[model samples]
Target: MIGFFVITLGPMLYSLYLSFTDFSMLAAPEWVGFDNYIKLFTNDPKYLDAVRVTLVYVLVSVPLQLAFALAVAMVLNRGLRGLSLYRSVYYLPSLIGASVAVAVLWRQMFGSNGLINQILDWFGIEGMSWIGNPETALGTLVILNVWTFGSPMVIFLAALRQVPQYLYEAAAVDGISRWGSFRHITLPMLSPIVLFNLILQMIGAFQAFTPAFVVSGGTGGPVNSTLFYTLYLYQRGFTGFQMGYASAMAWILFVVIALVTAVNFWFSKYWVHYDD
Candidate 1:
């Protein structure tokens, strides 16, 4: 509790106070009321662009990542040989995907003459500089996020094991098609896990930074297309020395994440099933 207060709650409360000031990190903080927050919304085009890119990143990556994870989990749950080894192999990416080395490797792979283009060349198809183009830069980051689906895949595998086999057997006995059984039995039973993974992935996606930071060379370019909110916050706080403004951004992000998570819980009542 002392550690939490010193590290987490203390810094949070300090930053909350700092958000209402004008601190350049070189001088004392001067109170500014709501000017920083208001300026971000009303005067800052780049801030709006960051918000737009982040929302797109969250919406697009979370669902796709969860779906891909669930599919892989279902496949691996089908009594595969060397199950433990396979699980570890699949789970490795999630462990390293956010690391600086992995992000650097990703940038190289998506470069103009990188492995991806080499593969396209083998197919007689031309490939552009994926990370260099604003249009496709963010999509590459989304793909990177999806590639780290191993964590959720592991969660889903555990949940799938807990689902009683008798349910599937009974569905088969009732002459239900495989798809129908999956839709009726598997889905309803897995709804709670789905919600859990959805919320987890959504929060993670919202906080994604390393990939964009490395791939875009900390600029969130080629045109601010990949300017994630966190990256912008880092720029403001560290790179540009606008700590107070960055604090405002951080608080806004905190509120946004809380609201989103609350909405997910509120909506879960309609679709997330529980045995109780």
Candidate 2:
């Protein structure tokens, strides 16, 4: 416990200290009080852009990913043949989804001469630069995020199984159609699980790094369209050696995530129902 405290709390304290200073890797840090935070809020356009991009990415990707996962989970819960095999096949992507190899493959697939454009060409559509255009680059990342919904799908499958069989039978006896049974019975029971997945996916989306980093060739290019908050922080701290500013950005992100999680928890009380 002492070691855990030291390991976790020590770095957090160090980062707090760093956030108040002007530190580069080469020079000793000079205490600048609230200058970093002030600059971040007042003068930094890039920081604002990062915030917008992060929020959009999280809001758009997480819900879409969860929705797709729930849909797939419902399909998988139907007692299909080769259930285990199908689950394994769907889950394989999530296992390797964030790896460098997969990111590279994504880059190639979204490139101008990539498979996507090739298919579009077969339909007589002109090939557009998917990753080279600022408007569509972030959208591509959102699609990549949706494609890795397998992990949440598996979780939803487990939750779906735990739903009481008697509820369905009761609904059927009352002349409820299959859709009505699902809407009235399955949905209410699944609400808590959906909330759980939403929080996890939202947090994960905020921290998304590898796909954007690799897809943009480490440039956050196409006019910074894919410059996620974490990627921007990485460029500042590691690439530019602006440790103090980066630490400030990191703390801001921590606060934002905390606030969002707290809000979710507060909202859950009204909607998330547990059987017991």
| Backbone clash numbers for all candidates listed | 0, 0
lDDT of 1 by residue, 70-119 (tens): 99999999999999999999999999989999999999999998999999
Give the per-residue lDDT of model 2 (tens digit) for 1-39: 998779998989999999999999799999999999999
Query: What is the lDDT for 271 in model 1?
Result: 94
lDDT of 1 at 8: 99
Error (Å) of candidate 2 at residue 100 is: 1.3
Show pairs that collide, candidate 2. Answer: none
* lDDT of candidate model 1 versus the reference: 0.95
Most TM-score-accurate candidate: 1
What lDDT does each candidate get? 0.95, 0.92
TM-scores across all candidates?
A: 0.99, 0.97
